[model samples]
Target chain A: MNEQLSMRQIVFMYLFISLSPVLRQIPTALADESGRSGYLSPFWSVFLILPLASIIILLIKSFPSLNLYEIMVHLIGKVFAKLIITLYLVWIIVFLTAKMNIYSLTLQFTLMPKTRSDFFMQIMLILVFYALLRGSKTIFRFSEFSLGPILLLIGILFACAITRLRTDYLLPVSTINLPSTIKASTSVIAVGGNMIIALFFADKLGISLTKKQVKKFWFGAIFFIIFSFVITVFTFGITGAGLTARLPFPFYITVKSISFFNIFERFEVIVTLICILSDFITICISFIILMKLIQWLFGLEQVWFCFLPLAIIVYYFSYFLSSTQFEFNFLYRYIIVNMNLLFQYIIPFLLGLICLLKRKYIKKQY
Target chain B: MIYIFGGLLLISFIKQKDVILNKKRNLVLFLLLSVCGIALGTVHMISPYIPSIAYSLEGILRTLLVNR
Candidate 1:
C-alpha cells in the first residue's frame, strides 16, 4: 500500500512549514518594514494564501494520483518539467540552507554560548537523516506528533505574556502608513508561498480535501503564524519592537521582555528551547521535501541513495551562505520572497490555467 | 576542516556501500556532489569573509525598491 497521511498530519505539515519563520528573523523583518501596522501584515498574508491554496488543491484533484511533479510532467514534457524542478530545487535548497545555518547561529547567540553552531546543525541533520531514511512519510508523522507540545508551550507563553501585551502597540489603525504596510504585508505573504509544499503531497494526503477542508487547512496553518506574529508585534509594540531588528530571533526577545506576576523570571529558556525544536522541525521537513523533489526530477526509484550526498551539499552551502546574519536577512527579505512569488504563485497559476484549457479542449473533442 | 569532511564522506561511502555496489551512475552523482561540497567548503574555510550573493542582491533591491 502507498503511504497515506491523515488530514491532521497534512494540516500540521502546512502549519510548521509556513509558521517556521516566526521563530527566527521574519518577525523583526516585518517590524522593520512597518512599525505599528506590522501586525496587520499576517492577516493580509493569510487572506492572500487562501485562494492560492484553493487553486493548488483543485489542480491536484483534477489530476488523479499525480502530485505537482507528475502533473508538471504530464502537462509539460519531461525535459521542461525537469528543468523547472531544477530551478525550484535551487530556490528551495538555498533558502533552507540559510535557515539551517542562521538558526544555528541564533543558537550560538541565544541558547548555546560555548558550542559551535555547526555542531548543532550537524547533530540536527543526523537526526533528520535517520528520520528520513524510510522516505517522506516519516517527516509528516514527525510533524503530526511534534506540533502538539510546541503549540501548547508557545500558547502558555503567549497567555502569560497577555498582561504585558499592549493593544496600544497596534494603535492608530488609520494613521498607519499605507505604502510600507503593503510592502510589509507582501513580505509576510511571501511565507505563504510555503502553501506550495502542500502540493508536493497533495495526492498522498489520503483524504480528498473538500472546499471546507481546504478552508480549514489554510486557515489552521495561517492561524499559528498570524497569532504568534500578532502577539510578538504587540508585545514589543511600535517602539519596543525596533529592538528586535538587532536580535537574531525576535520571539526570544519578546519572551524575555515579559515579566510574570513580578515573581517568576527567565521564561525565555523554556520558550527558546521549544522554538529551537520548531526550527528543527522546519529544517527537517525542508530537507525531506527537497529529497522528494529530487526523486521526481531524476525519475529515481531509490532517492535515499542521494540523501547523504545532498546532505553534504546542504551543509556546505549552509556554511558558505552563513557569512553573516545580514546575509540571512537580505536573502529572506529581498531575494527569496521574489523567488517565492515567481516560482510558487505565478508559474503554478499559469500551469493550472493551461491544464484547465487542455481539459476543456479534450472534452469538446469527445 | 577539509580532512573532517573527507572523513565524513568516507563514512557515508562505507554506510552506503550496498547501494553503491553495481550502481555506476549513483557513484558518479556522489562523486560530483562530494567534489562540489569540498570545493565550496574549502573556499569558505580559507576566506571565511566573502560577501555572499545575498549582499549583492540586497544592493540591487535597495536600488529598485527605493523604500519610501
Candidate 2:
C-alpha cells in the first residue's frame, strides 16, 4: 500500500539484511576446499574489497526516484525488462532458499539433531513469513529493534575471541599474488552482492541519503569484512590452514574453541543465534523484493497473497536438498558458481548498461 | 510445529469467511502462488538427493550464460 519507507528504517533494514551472519561462516569454511584454485589465502580481505568497491559505485550512480526495478524497466523495453526481472527473481529465490537450507541444516547438525529438517525449516519460514506479512515497514522496525542486541552479541564474541587472535596470521598478507587476489575478490562480490538490494529500497525509503548515512553503510560493511577477516585469519593461524580448511563453518569451529579460564566454553550457541537472525533478515529482504516484483509485473493489488506460496516453496526446497556434505559441495562449486554469476552479476550489469544507453538515445530524440 | 502454526494461522483467517471471500480472486491467486513456492522449495530440497536435477539446471544455466 505504502511505497516509501522511513530514513531511519532504511538504515536498520540495510544493516540487518546486509550482515547475513549465517552464510558468512560458509565462505571461509567452504572456500579452500571448493576450488579456491583461482582464489588467494587470507581470503576474507579480497572478499571485503570487492563489496566495498561495488557499494561505492552504486552510491555514486544514484537515481532520482526509480528503484533498481523501475530503472531497469525504463532503460530497457518491456520485453527485456520482463526477461531481466524473471532471471533476477529466480536468482533471489535460489539464493534465499540456499540460505534457509543452510540455516536449517546447521541447526540440525549442531543444536537439535533429533529434530527433522522439515520442522526447523517450517518454523523459520513462519517467522520470516510473519515478518514478510507485516510489510517492509514492520520488517525494518524489527531490524531497528533487533540491531543493537545483534551488534552487541557480535561485539562480545569478537572481544572474547581477540585474546586468542594471533597477529602473525595477518603478516605476509600482501604476499598473495595479484591474479589470485583478483580472482578471490569474486567471493567478496558474491557475498557483498546482496548490497544490490539497496536499489530496491532507495525509492521506497525516499532516501536522499546523507553523506553521513552512506559513509555509515560503508563503514559498517568494512567493519564486518574486517571482523570476518580477523576471525578467519586467526582461526586459520591458530588451527593451521590445513585443519581449518577441512571444517565447514570455520567460524563456528572457532567460536567453539573459545574458552575463558575454564569459566566459559561452548560459545557456539550465541554464534548460531547471530547467524540465524542475520540470515532471517536476509531472507526477509529477498521475500520483499519477490513480492514487489510480482505486484509490479502483474499489476496486482494485495501483496500478502503472494507470501504463502513462496513460503511453501522455500520450505519444501530446504527439506529435499543434500543429505550429505558432498552434495552440498557440488551444489556450491558447480551449480551456484554459474547460476549466481549469470543472474546476480552479468545480466544485471548488462541490463543496467542497455537501459542507460536507451535513455541517452531517447533524450537525444527529445 | 510449522504445520501447526501455519495451519492455525490459516484457520483463524478461514473463520472470518467475509474476509476470505471478499478477496476471493486474490486468495485463489495466492493459493496458486503458494503451490509454485512449494514446488520451488521441493525442487531445492530434492536437488541434492537427485543429483541429476542439480546437474541439469546448472547445465542449462551454464549454456545460457555461455551462449549469450
Candidate 3:
C-alpha cells in the first residue's frame, strides 16, 4: 500500500463517494415515504450516517496502523473475518450492479434508448478494471484534481436550478408516519457510509486518522448531503410530489427543467458530467477495495490475479441482477438498504465493542 | 466461448508463469477463482439467466413480500 497522502486528498475522495450515482433516487424515495415534506429525507439519512461513521472510525483506531480487513482479522477470529470479507464481496457486487443497472436505466430513459445497457456496463467495467489495476493512489489523485472543478459546477447548477423551487412545498419537514420516512431515507446510509471504504485503505493515507479528522469528515459530509437534498427536494418540491414519485430520475428531470433567461434550459449535461465522473471513480474504487479484501482473505501476495476475474464476475452479474426497473427499485428499497445497515453499522459497531472489551493481552492474532 | 476463456486463462498463466509453477497452493487458488469466473461468464453468455447472489436474495425477498 502506498503511504503518501494529504488530508485534502482523503476529504475529496470521501466527498465524491458520499455524493454518488444513487443520489438521484433519494428525493423520490423520500417523497414516496414522507409525502409533501419529502426534503427532510436527506437529513434523516445523513443523521444516521454520523454515528455509523464514528463507529467505523473507532473500529479503525482499535487496530494500530492497519487497514479495515486487517482490523477485522485482529478483532474477530480468522473464520469470521473471512465471512465478513465474503459478505463485502457480495455486497460490492450488488453495489456495482445496482449502479450499472440504474445508470443503464437512466440512459435508456434519457439519452440512448436504442442502445443495449449491457454494452454500457461492459465498457464501464472495463475502464474501471484498468483503473483498479493502476491502483487506488492513481484514482485518489484523479479525485483530488477533479474535486475542485466538479464541486464548482455542482454549486453553479444548484444555484441556477434551486431558484425555481416553491417555498411552500419546502416548508413542512414531514407529515407521514415515522417508520415509512425512515425507510424512505435509508439510501442516505449508502452515501454517508461510503467513507468506511476509505478506511479499508487507511494505511495508504500516510497519516494516522484521528477523532478530530473523523468529525471533520462528518461535518463535510453533512454539508454535501444538505446540498444534495436541496436539489433533490427542489426538483421534486416545485415540480409537485406526484411527478417526483413518477420519475425514476427526478434529479435529471430537475436539471432538464432548469432554463436561465430561456436560453440554457438544457443544462442536464452538467448533471451528466458530475454523475459520470463520480460513477467512474466510485466503480473503480469499489473494485480496488474488493480486490484488497480478497487478497487479505486468501493470503495472496499478488492482487493482479484476482482483479480480472472479479471484474469479469461483476460484469457478468451486472447483466442478470435486475431485468426491470421495478426489480431494481425493489432490491434497492428492501434488500440493499437493509444490508447496508447490517454491514456498515452493525458489523462495525460489533468490532468496536470487541476492541473496547478485549484485554491488553489480546495481541495481534494474525 | 471456451476458446476465449481458455485464451484468458492461458495468457494470464503465461504472464505469471513463475508464480503459478513455483507454488502449487497458489496455483490452485488462482485457478479456482479464475475457473469460477469463466464458468459464470460462459453461462451468462449461453443462457438467458444466470444465478447471482443479488437476484437470488431478490427472489427470496419477493417471495416473502408476496406471502406476507
Q: Write the per-residue lDDT of candidate 2 for residues A1-366, one digit (tens) a residue.
A: 475765556656656765643234434543454323212433544454454435434432445445666666666667777777777777777777777776777787678878877777778777886776677777777888998887787667667777776545434444444555555544544554455566666676453556665666666556545645545554654555555556656667777877756698888787777777877887888788888777666656666655665777666654444444445555655655567666656666665556455655645633
Chain B TM-scores of the candidates: 0.77, 0.43, 0.68
- DockQ rank order: 1, 3, 2
After superposition, the stretches of candidate 3 with alpha carbons farther than 4 Å from their true spots are A171-179, A210-212, A359-366, B1-6, B49-66
- Model 2: CA > 4 A from native: A1-3, A6-15, A18-62, A166-178, A351-366, B1-28, B34-52, B55-68
Local accuracy of candidate 1 as per-residue lDDT tens digits, A101-131? 7667677777787997778878877887777
lDDT of 1: 0.71
Global lDDT scores for all candidate models: 0.71, 0.60, 0.71
Query: On lDDT, who's better, 1 or 2?
Result: 1
Weakest 10 consecutive residues of candidate 2 chain A by summed lDDT: A33-42
The residue-by-residue lDDT of candidate 2 on B1-67, one tens digit each, is 3444357437644754454456766666656765565455445545535653455555687799999
What are the RMSD figures for all models against the true structure?
3.2, 5.2, 3.0
Q: Across all candidates, what is each one's fraction of true contacts kept?
A: 0.50, 0.43, 0.40
Q: Residue A360 CA error for candidate 3 (Å)?
A: 5.6
What shift in Å separates residue A80 of candidate 3 from its native position after superposition?
2.2
